[model samples]
Target: MSTNRQLVSVDYEIFGNVQGVCFRMYTEDHGKKLGVVGWVMNTREGSVKGQVQGPADKVDEMKQWLRTTGSPSSRIDRAEFSNQRDVPDLELRGFSTRYH
Candidate 1:
C-alpha cells in the first residue's frame, strides 16, 4: 500500500457538439478554478479529450463538470472516462489547453 492515495488521475472524452464551441476553453478555466492539473484538447475525431489529476474530490468535481456542464454553446451528449487510478503525487502541473 502507499500513502497519499488521495491523489487520482483520469482520462476523459466528451462527446457531441463539443468542438468549435469553446469546450476546451471552459474546461481549462474550470480545471484551473478547481485547482486541478491536466490538459484538454480537441480530438481529430471531433470530440474533446484530456487527462486530469489532483485530489480525489477535486477530480470528482472536474468529472462532474465535464459530464454535465461545458461551454454555453456546447451540447453534451455524454462523457466517457477511463484510466482511473490513485497516484502518490500529481503527474502534471496546472491546467491548460493543448494545441496538438
Candidate 2:
C-alpha cells in the first residue's frame, strides 16, 4: 500500500479586459469543476489574482485552462506558479465576487 499525495499551489494574474467580463465567475466555476481549492479576485491594478491548490497534475491542467480557455474574452498577460510549502487548510465551497 502506498499513501503518497502530491499537491501544488498556483498563483496567477490575468490581465486585459478581464474584469466586468465575468472572468472571475468563469474561473471559479471551472476551478470548482476541476476540484481546485482557492480564491480568485480582481486586483485594484486591473488584474485577476487567483490561487489554486490540488493534485500536482490537476493544478497544472487548471492553470493551463485558465491561461487559455478559462479566460473569457480577455487577454492573459501572464500566469506564474511556485512551489509552496505552507498552504492553508481550508475547503473552497464556491467562488464569489470580491471587491478590493
Candidates' TM-scores?
Answer: 0.93, 0.76
lDDT, candidate 2, at 16: 70
Candidate with best lDDT: 1
Q: Evaluate all candidate structures by whole-model CA lDDT and list the values in order.
A: 0.93, 0.70
Model 1: weakest 10-residue lDDT segment is 1-10
- Look at candidate 2 and give me any clashing residue pairs: none
- Overall local distance difference test of candidate 2: 0.70
What candidate 2 gets wrong by more than 4 Å, as runs, is 1-4, 83-97
The TM-score obtained by model 1 is 0.93
Q: List the residue pairs that clash in candidate 1.
A: none
Looking at candidate 2, the ten consecutive residues that score lowest on lDDT are 85-94
The numbered model that scores best in TM-score is 1
RMSD of each: 2.3, 3.0
